[model samples]
Target: MMSKNPNLTLTGPDLAALLCSRVCHDVISPVGAINNGLELLDEGGADSDAMDLIRTSALNASVRLKFARLAFGASGSVGASIDTGEAERAAKDFAVAEKKTEVIWNGPRAIVAKNRVKLLLNLFLVAYSSIPRGGTLELTLENPEFDAKFKIVARGKLMRVPAKFVEITSGQVEEAIDAHSIQPYYTVLLAEECGMELGHSATGEEIIFTAESVSV
Candidate 1:
């Protein structure tokens, strides 16, 4: 769906800036915890728990940064391929660190273009939002040799598509989109930019997203 209002339509740079702000906002908490841990260590009477805090905080920051590098940053040069294994590992690590989701990659380690990888990661984020009470995020790739197809399924007790997702993807919103809803809105743009079509469905406890490549 396309927006009729020019004010609601976002430019590439404006969307990119919002995504960057979202990533930085997410990273600041863990990074701040690391800094606080360092202060605790430098002060006297630091215990083993302080060391543990520092270790955990560092790991959290690292995992989130790695995942964001692929999901939100420029993970590769233009036209370069990204390692699927690396992307899978990053997603799994992030899920484990968050402790609210379990990411399972049921696909081969075939190299995919960076844009495709970004599209996958963005879809993963969409699925991630569906499960508020922790869930399984199952990622699968089909027909990798030809027109690669990717599916992300989220299953949990309270899995549901976000209202923002419907508004942004279907271009049905009357209000301007803010930072909180920009990620899903950006996911739609990224899919279109990569010449991929995104489809959404939900059944019972599962919310699924499927993306397939097409000629630009």
Candidate 2:
């Protein structure tokens, strides 16, 4: 069922809930691994190999938690500012699971807005969909203004933007699907919320999405 309070904007509590949900979802697996490893350690015949597994799982879980906080948590909580190297590290760390997509970062370290952080994560999801076989994802931030511009380029074999996804991005459609399509929807939502324009297109195995800040 849909929410009755349709006009309700996302409140601080709402955002907090969303962030908590995201954190829980991401940490579940590694937490489970750590638990299993601890159980193994408790076993009477535990060996060095078991201890190594425990250590590795704990480290992996720690990294995941730190990265998730940086990506999804509040900007101030992350740090005073995030450098390009830090951004690149965060992107690569977040993009590790899929293995098919390589995230490349460009541009100087600017204080990334919280909304942009969320948009970038969604953009990564969209890029993953474009390159089913695997490819390189390039993200560039430029022209920071009331309506700043962020460019995302996904290039690889068989990179084709789905027409329906394009329609949603262009404000021609309004329906939600899973993450595969939801990313584009949220892209449009974020643009509209920020008084920005979202442009998307595909050309010769390259799909590009750009968000331009709109003039008041």
Model 2 misplaced regions, further than 4 Å: 1-19, 44-60, 77-85, 96-100, 145-147, 156-188
Kindly list the per-residue Cα lDDT of model 1 for residues 1-216, writing each as its tens digit.
Answer: 664323347887888888888888878998888788788878854768778887888888899888989987887677777888888998899888888898888878888778788888889988898898888999998865458899999999878898887776776777776778888887877777677888899999689999898864
TM-score of 1: 0.89
State how far residue 101 of model 1 sits from its true place (Å): 1.7
Candidate 2 collision pairs: 147-213
C-alpha TM-scores of all predictions: 0.89, 0.66
Report how far residue 177 has shifted in candidate 2, in Å.
7.6
Distance from true location, Cα of 215 in model 1, Å:
6.9
What's the lDDT of the predicted structure labeled candidate 1?
Answer: 0.82
**Clash counts for the predictions, in order:** 0, 1
Best by TM-score: 1
Deviation of model 2 at 33, angstroms? 2.0
